[model samples]
Target: MSLPPITSIHNPKIQRVRALLGRRSEREEQSAYVVEGVRLLEEAAAAHLHPQLLLYTPDLAPRAQQLVHTFQKAGVECLPLAPALFASVAGTESPQGLLAVLPLPASQLPSQPNFVVIADNLRDPGNLGTLLRTSAAAGAQALLLSPGCADAFSPKVVRSAMGAHFRLPMWAAAWDEIAAWIHQHSLSVFLADANLGQPYWQVNLRPPLALVIGSEAEGPGPQSAALATGYLSIPMPGGVESLNAAVAAGILLFEVARQRAAA
Candidate 1:
């Protein structure tokens, strides 16, 4: 039998989850983050990343209850929370009746990574999340976030990423660290820009490369530019100035995939 449900919103575990959901620092401090609903946890399980703790409501559906039982069987602490208390802590307007605290995935770049995505000062959670999703789909070996970028494990990002966090190797690094990694790997760094440099489709993306995507507002940072072996541009004949960061990333990343496939 499972332990009794927690009734207080101020319960220590509940408070911790709230802090993790609300603040990046709290997550960094604990080396953990919260994921809402059943889907994320399912992805986490698929990635072999298990949650440390799970909180759910008494009225949870049977399918979701089964999910809770799976975690319970795995030795994860499963706690029940009163509906009102769960509502108080849930990040979504309509609580999914399931929340889990999962450790931050400690993923490292594979040896001889031929493809990586570098996000330069991207602050929008949705954009960053989409980039993570696209990178995983496009077969990038890792993702590097530059300074001033939004926290990769932030709740909004985790939700928007649709479980990419469970699978992608992502790290937030200083520019110097990013540069050193590029050199160590001998990767050809290509910064994506709206204007300047060779058109992206024309470039031979089959080589071992790191693609740098910049913030939509300020473009690439000086440090980012300093690290670039070259720049890439997507041709916009419609006379548009630029594209959404995620859209640009999707287009560029798929192009990389296409080139490698045809090669």
Candidate 2:
């Protein structure tokens, strides 16, 4: 096997990686995304994804060293990078000094999804990312986002998603398109709301079901709201208006998982 290559920050390939790191369009155009941190890298590799390139700083731990060689042996082009340069390209505040360029899976949603979460106009990156992460962990089959929602594959979102992007099938479309998809699949669309809705535990989440959670600033969009098969909500004490988008989604997704597993 060829030894790893060492390159400077100004190298053309390195610059391209950094540029792609910042732009969602570039990531889509290249059909690859930058995965940072040791944990995420491990998840990507454990998922059996072949990295196009793996970049790491000199301070790589002994475990990271083993991974570098293993990944290199698996045909990944490992690049040794300077810590300062790695930090310059990282999206997180505490740089992990390691990242990989991974091609995203192009799996489309199933025609008839057993379970999913429809995100509408969700603007918060952290919330969206956490939702993706939780959805993947809870074993949701897919995620469909409305036009105004945060970009699922954006750097911040991807970082928060961890390796969820690789694990979950996702699509971004308009509310009308999403509604049409639900009907075509004969899906039971459940809209999560704060009022005039049954408690989530009251619903049967098994079979064809799509749970909808709208933007924090506003609830589900008009189209999804109108088409919702049922409006669902979690019963909360203390007179709270609602929970955070991420928390609410986690609850709903696990409920689906609970129902599906029991059934």
Candidate 3:
């Protein structure tokens, strides 16, 4: 049972997906985001996230066809689009001929999380995504994005995160909410700073701690800095100045994991 392909670019579904990919406002309005490629689709399935809509071309590879069939049988709204049309709206250079519009999962901090990551004023989608991925891998229980941070659900960030969005508890929040949450959890909050802070390794990262990484350009703002329980800096003996925001986060997060593993 083959479905008719969507050949017109003006089709409402096509237009909607294009809008979701191109505009942050549209994504927020619809409470959905677009994800492309087979690997991502597989990750979504593993995380048990059912897509609101699945679009693929008839030329999909054998494995992709199987996935489409699986979703279709599971009552997902699976549709076919012309290959060129998919390419026109796709963010990647090479289209895998599969994409989905998945609803944004509800994000909340865990009741008793031991570790959390706060990305303050992070502007780069690549860095934000890497931070999300690294935080998840390092076993942080939640992630918080400051008001000015990049859209975590943006296509670039989603793609780079490699499905961390589905697995990690994360959301954007204001400084006040962040401060309240930190205090409520009784977690020590450490701001990552290049200057005027104790060495990261010297700080106690055992558990129940929150690590904050600010923008590469401005670092954490005054409001965010004021909320920190302490400031931490990585020792760069080579005098390289500072690590990329994501790299610093990865180093500090894993150190927390390492300390807890031994405890």
Candidate 4:
């Protein structure tokens, strides 16, 4: 059942949403994040990701209204917000009619993963988000983040990812833990470097492997470099110095997929 529309900007629920939108720390502390837009909400629903709370405006279009109804029938707490109040807490320039407070999905790494992605010092949320999308599309079994990468669940990353969060297991761990996991899996670790090792296509990507992508500005840190069994460079005959981290990740990940498919 829908609660009475909240008119006050001081409402506790509104305040909680604002906090979640603004702070990564708050999200981590609560183990929840705010997800905005009809598209993301639809994806969440399709994945059977139930929300802890649903907030919407009264003037929602038919489809959005139906989405609100669906959540309501699922027994989620639905709160209607005044339009201005909704806009105030929304992360986007234009507020979507609906947003939700959802717990982070319980994604776990598989026991034996043939392919994985690791983000090393990738500070750009857009790049990291694109990497997440590409990694999921390429059938990576998991994504691991080193310390310096942007928070994967942040609003901008989440928006840029376009629902990729629901599709893969992700973890942010220390170098020690990462190295231990790689060792346990007995997987080869390859660093994607602009000028190093064999050409990416020549690499035998058929084995269980983890690809580490670093920042374009700083490249991989010592921690990541220490873990690489080898490096792979994309061939660029066009004379570009280096590709964007996310673009490089896409090219490499898809190559892995292509090679595995042909094998």
lDDT winner: 4
lDDT of 2 by residue, 107-213 (tens): 58876577888887898988999999998999888988888787677778988898788788998877778778888888888888887588888888887888888
Position 63, candidate 3: lDDT: 92
lDDT, candidate 4, 1-263, per-residue tens: 54677989888989999899899999999999988999999999998889999999999998899999899989999999989888888999998779999997665988988799999989999999999999999999999999988999999999999999989889999999999999999989999998898999989999999999999998888998999999999889999999999999999999999999999
Off by over 4 Å in 3: none
For candidate 1, write residues 115-234 as lDDT tens digits: 999999999999999999999999999999999999999888998899888778997888999899899989999989998899999999999999999988989999989988889999
**TM-score per candidate:** 0.97, 0.92, 0.97, 0.97
What range of 10 consecutive residues in model 2 has the weakest lDDT sum? 1-10
- The per-residue C-alpha lDDT of model 3 at residue 228 equals 81
Candidate 2 residues lying further than 4 Å off, grouped into runs, are 1-7
Residue 118 in candidate 2, Cα distance off native in Å: 0.9
The per-residue C-alpha lDDT of model 4 at residue 191 equals 96
Query: In candidate 3, where is summed lDDT lowest over 10 consecutive residues?
Result: 200-209
Error of 1 at 257 (Å): 0.2
Candidate number with the higher lDDT (2 or 3): 3
Please, what are the lDDT tens digits per residue for candidate 3 over residues 119-237? 99999999999999999999989999889899999999999999899889997888898889889889888899999688877877885888889987888898778888899888888
